[model samples]
Target: MDRTTDTTALPLIPRAALFGNPRRAGAQISPDGGTIAFLAPRNGVMNLFVAPRGRIDAARPLTDERRRGIPGYAWAHDGRHLLVVKDNDGDENFHLHAVDRETGAMRDLTPHGPIQASIVKLSPRHPGEAVVSHNARDPQWPDLYRIEIATGRSTMIAENPGLAGFDVDEDFALRLAARLEGDGSQTVLRPDGAGGWAPFMRFAPEDAMTSGVLGLFTADGRATLMLSSAGRDTAALFRLDLETGEATMLAEDARADIGEIIVRLHENTPLAYGVNYERNRYVALDPAIQPDLDALDAAGIGDWGIQSRSEDDRFWIVGAASDTAPGVAWLYDRKTRALEKLYDTRPDLADAPLAPMRPVVIAARDGLSLVSYLTLPADGGSAPRPLVLLVHGGPWARDSFGFNPYHQWLANRGYAVLSVNFRASTGFGKAFLNAGDREWGRAMDDDLLDAVDWAIGQGIADPSRIAIMGGSYGGYATLAAMTRNPERYACGVDIVGPSNLETLLATIPPYWEAGRSIFTRALGDPATPEGAALLRERSPVHQAARLARPLLISQGANDPRVKQAESDQMVAALKAKGIAVTYVLFPDEGHGFARPENSIAFNAITEHFLAAHLGGRAEALAAEEIGRSTAQLLEGAEILP
Candidate 1:
């Protein structure tokens, strides 16, 4: 294994090749195992393409969506219709659409206006029905409804009873619900059989996000697979008996928590559970699936992403991807033990010089382990090169090793890329996650700073030339880095980052009402005097006058989570303080840039901005590029080359 960083000159991979939409993606097998459906462009917009199983060339467009392509769709139990989720102008108010495969007719099941919806349970027992959660009645919390796919009729099954979220069993029975206490703790409830709810489990504020029910057992609906770090250092998987409240450990990882579980859809039993340390590794619980896992491991195609399998379990659709390679979809014949390639997401990158991502564990200032991934450039000598501290959003999310175009773009432009999993990041343990509580701008920002110091200490990053960039919570981190430690970074890029904690909490979308306790726990409640004072102290908008470095901020005008007002006030504050800042706004985007043209346009400007401040290579943006995008230059136009 070559851990040495590449320093030789290589061909420049085009920005379009890296950032452009894939030719085809999200290929899946229908439930009945007779047909296959994938997402491909139709009249330049992404739409569903259906074909017979095992035949990729014969795929045809099933749905014709003109404005924004269908982002995701799933096969219904009957195999007669496809359940599709879509949003308008990136507002993220998802609507459930059922497309009749034979007639290609689409019906909006939940036609309610501007509300978030998600598929809760799709049971094989009820072929014509699905349990979905919609935030129609209340803007903040989602209420459960049983929707009939055939007639588009919806009936309220169990209205959300002020819990943050709910989990259902295979029988579509409400098994678990989590309620956030005022003290930042979480109480898990189960049906008491007397038509009321009984407390099943409880989690302290520090263990709130770390411990929760994964799902109820499909076998009996009386047992649940849960993750808890109550008396441990890391969150581990356990099977809990609903009747006795006794838990038995199923799996435990010293360094990481259980990331995902692969369950047998029909039986509702977990087949394998995955632990994501540096990369993802799966543990097979059922011996029958071990041979398939062995076959996949022997193939060495790349990290496997199993998409779907036939109802009879004969054929499987999987995707293989790596940090350097885009992704190659495959179809595996389980009976024959054969693997066939479907399509390479980006064949242009087949022979391109993409940087390799290396996982390293660094220590924070407080000696806590900080898991991180780093990518270095492939051009010439490396004498402490300029570094791009790429922070992931989801103050709750952790960065993993994968095919990241942003990392490749930065590395190709002659900058070292480092993504750190700060204290509050998930997949670690309750202790690490709790460390981030009420320490958003304090300890969370410290972990990033410590990462920079470690990078410089290892001679992989130049101490004098480093830039911080991220989106969502990452975007908030970018602003915090610039305002809190102005002399540390040469520049910063924040995409859709909340500027004011107080305003951000105040304006959170209604559907997030259930999770308000988590928010109040992480960042103090702005409604209270102490919480309000803390939020004000951590808000970047109030500290904008302290910025001494150039900053590039991007936002989707229709972002529902972090409203456009966040960027507006941040930019206004920077302008009032006479600070140099570049702001880009996309009218048709939400949270992040989704459309290809907007993504390319933003990257074009971002490249130029990074180059101007950090002396990195930047692809020149042509006039035609800007003409094709809907991006508006809010301010700092001079930063564009």
Candidate 2:
């Protein structure tokens, strides 16, 4: 196959390239008001990137030569250092590092290997001090640690003897370590500073659970606990005593499920806080600060990180994002009530014609309602077109209505895309999540089919042409749907999805060893002799013969979580069966594609396969003329291809 040398003439553009290669995706401004950093894939590795204060482009590597490579990054309070974390590979051990921002020097703070260190809070006021949770002392209860950025040493502030989370007081002292009971109601632990921890005060756990703690508020040099809770099962705003533990309800934030609360410190009064609803819009704190934030957003501020407590309380650093705007730095002047768009991550996508996602609902089987977020094509077309069921990675993780890149691409392809939040999805509460615990290939699979049914009933989906695609759990479902109900789906695209359940359960990396406890409850009997047999019953590998449809499977060789052996063994098994199957292995990636080159290559094949099967417009691969050459590479497989 002669590959296309005209990179500019390719039928489809790489989503990763078009998305501007966000290395540390979701980069935000630090509270200290000095530096900026983001997550990005540098040199084919996902690491934290630091852009120093007053200089966005001068950003450098915050972490040193990491062994496993820095998989994730977070800012410390002083903004002088960064906390580089490693977990995506499966071993959840987060070796804490105090990275010197100015010089790019890094040292392991937690030297403790294999111990999962989780950062709960990084002081915006005190740069050196940090609040992190680690299982250093005990495994069941992860005690909180206060670390000094400069010294590279840590002080155990609160031993949560139980399952608890820490919330800092105004003095920046460890005051409230909220202890969660398995049932409900939290025991608020306060420090006696006598080398002991006790309940500084008490509030109804029922209230705390319902209202949802807003935050730890400081005024008049004292601390108060802000509650976004009520007596019921929803979240609202309420204020409580840090010491006395007294409680008072603020304005009933009826929206409940407090999106994210950002508190602004004012003079002995309520600090300006931005309370977001459902990760969508925000309620400008105290009505007075609304205009400030609105003006900032209008000015294209991508990030809003309040720094210091000034008397005017108006000067704040603002970051921004838009349909077309990537992450950017902005300056919001409260005095002038003006916002200045300071920086841009990528200027190329400025006129890319991005669209906001619209939230919609499609009913599932059994009359149960299903929720989804849809992004329509910029170039409008009629209904009854080939659509894609873009299943999210986590079958348990709910898909929110937002601007997802996958959804955007499918929408642009003149297809109505459906993202289903199936049963057992989180955020809907324990019952919903628990509902999916044991129903992996059964009800969970049913939910995917029900979504297709819903789409067809609404005349929004093409009856004869449909594709099922997802990553991780989504990938598993894609194969399962094609295997169990071959006639329903025309093609299946599985990206790092498990083919066999028994292998997936036993083969997960060491970092996920402890996760077996959760896995057992969901899948059943991880250790028992009969357990393997039970998992095989649900595995797509065991049911491969049932699929008479075209299939494409991609696996990352270094995928610690899923492992390459999974795809290798299954694809090999299918080929032996004289079934046609396409298998692509990426040596650089792990559970998912972390590099742009792999993502572009993998997505190109998926696009071509979908177009050929679903009769959508064909797109030629640019970098690799081997896309079809690659598809031709899998021509003789035994399984369906």
- Top TM-score prediction, candidate number: 1
User: In model 2, where do residues sit more than 4 Å from their true spots?
Assistant: 1-11, 23-72, 86-93, 113-115, 124-126, 135-144, 155-256, 265-279, 296-319, 322-329, 353-356, 428-437, 499-538, 558-560, 563-577, 622-641
lDDT of each: 0.87, 0.62
Please give each candidate's TM-score.
0.96, 0.76
Q: List the residue pairs that clash in candidate 1.
A: 7-380, 139-510, 139-511, 140-510, 140-511
**How high is the lDDT of residue 566 in model 1?**
97
Worst 10 residues of 1 by lDDT: 1-10
lDDT per residue for candidate 2 within 1-641, as digits (tens), equals: 22211222223434554533553354555655555666555665555677764576677765544323565566665656767755434334566777677777878777775676876765456667777777867654677777777886788876665535666654456655665543334556666678666765444533433333444556553556464443433354556655556676553444334444556553224434433323445555477767765776565443344432222344455545543345565555678886555455555555555545666666666654566665655554445667788888766566764446676666555566778777665444333455676678888889888878877887778778888999999888888888889899888888889888787876775434333455666776756667666687888888877888888888877676677777777787787788888787765567776545566667767777776677664355564533412222344233223
Error of 1 at 530 (Å): 2.3
* Residue 258, model 2, lDDT: 40
lDDT of 1 by residue, 84-189 (tens): 9889889989999999998889999999998889998887878889999998998776888999999999998777768787788767777888898888788989
